[model samples]
Target: MNLYKEPLSRFLISYNLCSQRSAKNFVKNNEVVVNGNSIKDAAFLVDTENDTVIVGGKILPQVKHKYIMLNKPEGVVCSTVSDSHKTVYDLLKGNFNETELYKLKCVGRLDNNTSGLLLLSTNGTFVNQLTSPENEVEKTYFVKLRDSITDKKSYVLKAEKGIEIPPENKSPAFISKSAFIKWLSDESLEITITEGKFHEIRRIFSALGNYVVKLKRLKMGDFILDETLNEGEFKFL
Candidate 1:
């Protein structure tokens, strides 16, 4: 099988198909066509000649090389653009030229108020490899709690019995074997999750009768937040 490689973000930006932010938004919204089929990820690779590229009713030319990272700060939305609040893109202004920055897309989302390491790239396969459930890449978090954890609670948490079932019920439940928690302080903890679910860490602690006061991701897959990067800063990976 013949394969062609080009960074999806670069392709969209180089063609002047859309702004850097818009191109990413388009891909996430499944507006870009690949081989005549709509594909949602901006990192998707295609055969330049055989694959078709269409954006907002126009065709786009291909280009290459796209990867990025962001030290997300609290209060910023993870989206490409937003009407109500600052988005991750707003922080990148002036850092990259309009042409060079177009098509960059986030690998995963961080809640508006949650902060820390965030990855972006136009390498679809690499993104998938890192986030895939089977890959089970470990994600670490530094969390602060509203209450102190007791030994019993720590035992329970370490036993991985704090997770819930169906994840919506008010009553607490546990996953047979999935997560682990380590206390860093009476009111702080480090959690490692193999599965990424919506508001998972917060929910688990909530079930344990403790509320999460602050949350920050420390690592994802092989990447870690560099000490040199301050909040809202970003780097290429």
Candidate 2:
């Protein structure tokens, strides 16, 4: 964005090619080429919107922003790269190859033990806006409880009355948004929330003297998880 007048080294850094110091070194070493002309000056003016910038031997591909809706499977972390656990990106490895251009990030994360609908995008702005609490983006989840609450109506009433969630690091307990609860069975139901606190659903249930046995996201804003897409499968939107 607005990269035309920026310095060559700054441009490459913004594109995550390397750290600022590393970018300067890359330029100084004559490892960067602009429009087929090799340039060693890190401060060389660039027209990134139009002029091609090449590193090593390949031209940096212009990012064609991608939006993906993945049916995240249980045991998969919602991250681009990880050292221990399997990540959602691993499921999409073969679909796209331009990692430098398209750095897809999950809009919001699902717990590794959780499964279901997850949204990812190459556009950082879109992800920020969609995940912002001010936007009040609603997310729906299907949860299986370890035990029945006996009276679902009471559970709804308690939630509607507002349950106070413990704050981080000894901060004051704050009341989170009241969830819209819909029961499918004695121990299964859907809960919709506009907030994205850490382990929010599990915490909510825990506060109510219950435990979540299984959790799966079903809907987010205007998009619903396609039942046709099996776990770990994804489709572009």
Candidate 3:
């Protein structure tokens, strides 16, 4: 009935208590309890924020998922575990407990050198929806080139069709999918790509004989970088 309300059977599955079929059976067999009362209807709605769910004498935890928008800074790794480098998680330690912090995952990772709109979330489904290539989520980047490209239109045409990136450092040669390019100036441009291939944007420019001096992502899908967030700052959505 409300955003926080979910069917008892589905809530059981969301908590990883049981499979969908088993959840139905658990409710039907009077084995599941909600708010101290036996719940026989699998579809019976429970307010996830207020109702308590119990199964097999064990209370199921209602995990609260959080979405964070981080203006990641350079030199910070996008991993939860990194022995030699400062990870993005290091910036988030005080914000969440150890368990919840570790559960957070980067939706689409930004390399140590690349910085801009980065998404972190505890919801695996939300992460998958945004990062999945099947969804074709568009990622926009603000690029600064090492040198001005005189024949920008030609290269832009090539990129629009597709650019072939050579294999390097164990990464196989790949052809980028079609992309949209808008030149901001002689030495700068913004590119929008759907696929988040490894070093894809840099490689695309490299393949075109231009080197990228700096790269910052400005947007991903419907989410744009919050201009107010300074480097390394994050806020919950």
Q: Rate the local accuracy (lDDT) of all candidates.
A: 0.72, 0.82, 0.86
User: Lowest lDDT 10-mer window, candidate 1?
Assistant: 1-10
Task: Count clashing pairs, candidate 1.
Answer: 1
lDDT of 1 by residue, 57-172 (tens): 67765444466778899999978668888988889889878665656667677888799999876655556767777777888899998888667466455447534533555634
Tens-digit lDDT track for model 3 on 1-237?
132366677677776666887877767875788888987888898766577888877888865668899999888999988888799999999988999899888998999899899999776566877888988899999999998888888978999999889987878998899999999999999999999888999999988888998999999888899999999999998
lDDT by residue for model 2 over 125-198, one digit each (tens)?
Answer: 56776788888889999999999767999889877777988765544567878788999999999999998888
Instruction: Return the TM-score for candidate 3, rounded to 2 decimals.
Output: 0.80
Estimate candidate 2's RMSD in Å.
7.9
Per-prediction tally of clashes:
1, 0, 0
Residue 187 miss distance in model 1 (angstroms): 0.7
Report the C-alpha displacement of residue 64, candidate 3, in angstroms.
Answer: 2.5
Query: How many Å off is the CA of 6 in candidate 1?
Result: 8.9
Better of 1 and 3 by TM-score: 3
TM-score of every candidate: 0.67, 0.71, 0.80
